[model samples]
Target: MGETGKQVVLTYEGVKKLEEELEYLKTVKRKEITQKIKTALSFGDLSENSEYDEAKNDQAFVEGRIALLENMLKSAKVIDEDDITTDKVNVGCTVKVKDVEFDDDIEYTIVGSAEADPGKLKISNESPVGRGLMGKKVGDEVEISVPDGIIKYVILEIKK
Candidate 1:
């Protein structure tokens, strides 16, 4: 959590993934970076050593990522799978929608920002389409505004 006190919403799987990444960064990555730093130090001349500079930069990035992961975990609110319902569009719901213009059907899993992966069809609840579909029923029609333009979609199904 940051000073804003905003909670980081995550599903059980998302939490597990983050935890695993955090563990890897703290254990394996930290040790590897430390070794690199040591090896670079052995080469002498700190000011002009490119290896040392690169190693230090990598160390800083790793430390920063560790801090970010820790903060996110501290503020994480895991959504229970059992609590998800098919009644309406909501986080953790997989929605099937028909694109009005192209007449194509697409399935999307609504997830939190931290778990949103467009390539995997996992959309954030705050996204344009996700927001437009939120609280909508199976037969509901929605118009979502994207960077390109407005897109119309009809909700066909909602499942947990």
Candidate 2:
């Protein structure tokens, strides 16, 4: 669905969310699109039917999303909460770090890409800062290169 054999990593909560979305797309969205198509078809002249064209486009988009969700779910590898450890920064672990340059403290929850929400401080494990912090214990200093510049951070704590 994505790559030939690329695995989609997700947390249990992430998996649940995806499943719920897939369900909604398959049931509610599909029905809504079908109703729109039926209504457009009843309007007559297919050659000048902008409503029909728009409904078809919406149907196509919904179908594509359904396929994508199915593929992602099929390839999902859900991380178990019980498997999370505080020995180091890892997926499912929340790590606190102090910015060495600005003297600011921030907490980030390392999650799989599917569950990453930067606004909420849930960062993808593949992100620069997350990658730099991985396998690092408390007191470890890390320097990560971002688009802006290199940021230096000292690990303060790690917890599940």
Number of backbone collisions per candidate: 0, 0
Could you give candidate 1's per-residue lDDT for residues 54-105 as a string of tens digits? 9899999999888888888889888899999998999999999999999999
- How far residue 38's Cα lies from its native spot in candidate 2, in Å, is 0.8
lDDT of each: 0.91, 0.90
Give me the candidate number with maximum TM-score.
1
Best by lDDT: 1
| Runs off by more than 4 Å, candidate 2 | none
| C-alpha lDDT of candidate 2 relative to the true structure | 0.90
Candidate 1 residue spans exceeding 4 A from truth:
1-4
Model 2 RMSD, rounded to 1 decimal: 1.5
| Candidate 2 C-alpha lDDT tens digits along 65-95 | 8888888888888789899989988898999
What's the C-alpha lDDT at position 49 in model 2?
Answer: 99
TM-score of model 1 relative to the true fold? 0.95
